[model samples]
Target: MAGQAGRSAGFNKEDLSSYEYKKILCKKDEIKTLEDKTSHVSDYELCEETVNDFYTKFRTNHDTLKLKCDNENGSKCCRDVNYYLDHATGIFKSSILNDSDKNKLIKIVEEIWEPNLRAKDIYICERQTDLDSTRKRSILQHLHDLKEDEDYILSYTKDYNNHLKEKWEKIISYTDSKPSSLFVKIENNSMGIVENYKNFLDSSDYICGNNLNDLSAHDIKISTDMDDFLTTISLDKISLNVEKNLCFNKRYVDMLKYKASNLQRINNALSIGVAVLGVLLIFIFLYEFSPLGRFLRRRTKKQIEVDENANDEIPDSYENSENGIPYISYHSTSH
Candidate 1:
């Protein structure tokens, strides 16, 4: 029973009533002062009402942003979030004002919030490869200043736009080919060349597939029509032979390109081989006095001697004497 009594003491309901009484007294005095100062007006709208009106106007003006935001859930939250921002801050600020009149001044801030944001220095932290270290530092400094001043909404919006821009830029940049050569595993020799028209041609399929006839006559309709007209060759006219011809032509073009590339490789190899051979020849020439060179020289001299002797045999015009014969001209034939 003592333990239960101790637990009951911890859950004192009077403690809450005392705090509530003091808050109610403070709020009553604050409200009385506010009403007296604004005697010109009989009644004022609640903070929730003012905030709701502001949001309604904002959504009306920026319908697309509202739609996109709602679709993402982050935007839909703004519909109900107005009351929290207004009530929470206004209530706290109202209780702390030197006089109730000052609270009215604070409440007026909601009207100028969007305009004030527009007037402030907006910082966009974009991922730019071309940005130098100095520029990056400056952007960072601007971001820090905006955040420190509690001007975060504009900064946050800028950041969101910048991120979207970078993402789209990446998508566009992908249309430009990436060489695997930067990674050392894919050397320049093995790198494949990408044609500029590859993406343009590939994307044409999607562009042409849409039913442009269903669309109302506008700029887009006219453009799609022109493209379709130009590319629309008759199916009956497109014979198998014509297809084969196109295929053969494409293959021939590819074969030529391949041959050109192979020729370049062969030329490069030949150049390397020539350089290696030159170096080897230079080494051989420098060591001409070596034993191997001497042996080769001797062998060449003996071959030269043998070649001369083979060609030195006398012609039929030479006559012979008993011991040694002096060469004399004789052209007689014995019968």
Candidate 2:
């Protein structure tokens, strides 16, 4: 039977890429189901099977991959006993419109399946190889299906693919590729993958069957310490910014205070200057109006006349007969 329909039938580049991605994911899941079945038979069944057996067993009904008909806890009426990849891919690729659908589908698959495959036994060599092939195929298909060139996304994917290829080469050179590599790169690039994975986990709101809850208190402590370190750095930045603002405020306030003080000083000086000028004007008025000033003026006039007579003739000393008072006599030459 074919798979169920997706939420939207609207065709877009994203939708097309999603469709292609779903097909690729269907292919990967099919391989995983085969890998799981073979693992039960023998460890060697991973690689010993012929190409004909590879196709045959992979195409068979995988009971291990089947969903329960009555999964009351999780199925939520999606009890078709079909894998999500098969269900989503069938609906998307029934008709090929664009690559966006294919990209979206592949992203969905990676978002869903990678975590599951990672939590499984990490030592499976054939399983790891299959996952690598699947990852490469997804990356290549995405590159092919992009409607417009997104340089940044393309560059990031290329870098990520190159990293995966390098890891695969390293693993293949030493021992056959281990199943752990399925998520090793992802875990190493946790910054990139964790947020997307969290979104996926939240979207389905389901814990993956393979997600392990094996972290001890010590691991949690380490994680907490790392979180504290980041928090401390952020706090330090905030504190520095606050301190800078405070210092700027203080400087601005000081400047205002200084200006106020200067203005006060100027006002005080103006008041003192005005007072001094008033006192000087009062002194001048008193000097002009006083009796002493008039007497000084009269004395000055007599001195001036005496000096004029002295310039004309010599002055002789004379005494009054009755009082015997010494006096200066001035002779004037007739001109």
Candidate 3:
């Protein structure tokens, strides 16, 4: 979903047209997040190196092997991932901005990013594309590299439907599209992704099979699981920069989003705990510390005494009177 929402949001024709222009809309919750992220880094000057570094950094992540760079021959001034990301924060910040600026960002990436840089940088490629036919351990997206998408895998960070279908094909074949222990074993082992590793891998490079693999009533169906698998993948939620998912430097964009998500989750849990604690503290203050508590306790004690006296045994003989008045004995024992 880009820009504003549906008719319930009331969007006129002109506004809707502009909003649909490859737009990236910032949700209300994400505004504070965007500001925090923007301030954490410096503004970057747009340049060829700025674009190139952004590309390289996004491509190099935990999912892929480190690039071979010679100080003299290779990238002499290649910036590290975290530092360069800050240096190139300008692009990452664009995710919150949905306008003609998004188009500008894409143009900048295409102009400066060397065509040679794909999702799999030869070594990264080897790791990404390996199918594990012979059981060679490697970084696998769909568990066979499934060369069908290799032609354009390097072209963009987003792993296209064809690419995911390749992986899903392998998974379904092994699972027979039926839910069973075998399916779970096959998915957990290979081809099927179970976690949101957007921080570690490119958003487009892999399709997480988590939603599908989760415990559900329906068994895996190839038509829906494979043909309609793209519906299961939402780049808007998964990709850090939706505008740039089609452009470049998606991994770093995704990383920032990943970190922010973790922080948000923590904040949510802490908020609940804090609310509970606050309620408990208020109760403690009213009961043990405040004057109201003391007054309430005194009243409660008097009420309890009254209740006890009210419930005391009725006079059996009426022989004891505090005022020393003579009392007559009742014949209750005989009755």
Write down the TM-score of every candidate: 0.20, 0.19, 0.26
> What is candidate 3's lDDT per residue for 67-99, written digit by digit as tens?
343332121112122112222333343344344
Off by over 4 Å in 3: 1-277, 313-335
> Which structure is stronger by TM-score: 1 or 2?
1
User: For model 1, which pairs clash?
Assistant: none
Give per-residue lDDT, candidate 3, residue 324.
90
After superposition of all CA atoms, the RMSD between model 1 and the true structure is 26.8
Task: Report the C-alpha lDDT of model 1 over 213-326, residue by residue, as the tens digit.
Answer: 222211111111222322222222224323221211232235345556766899999999999999999779855967878888889999999988776755434555545765
Who is ahead in lDDT, 1 or 3?
3
lDDT of 3 at 305: 94
Name the top lDDT candidate.
Answer: 3
TM-score (C-alpha, index-matched) for candidate 1: 0.20
Candidate 3 clash pair list: 118-154, 129-145, 131-144, 158-204, 159-204
Predicted candidate 2 versus true structure: per-residue lDDT over 1-335, tens digit per residue: 21223322331222233233323334444443433343233223233343224334333332223222123312211111123333233333322425564455445444643334331232211112233343432322222223222332244443433322422232222222332222211111001111121112112111122211221111111111222322212111222332211111222234335556766899999999999999999877776888877777789999999999986664334432336666675568999
Q: Of the pair 2 and 3, which is ahead by lDDT?
A: 3
**C-alpha RMSD by candidate, in order:** 26.8, 26.0, 23.8
Every candidate's lDDT: 0.32, 0.33, 0.35
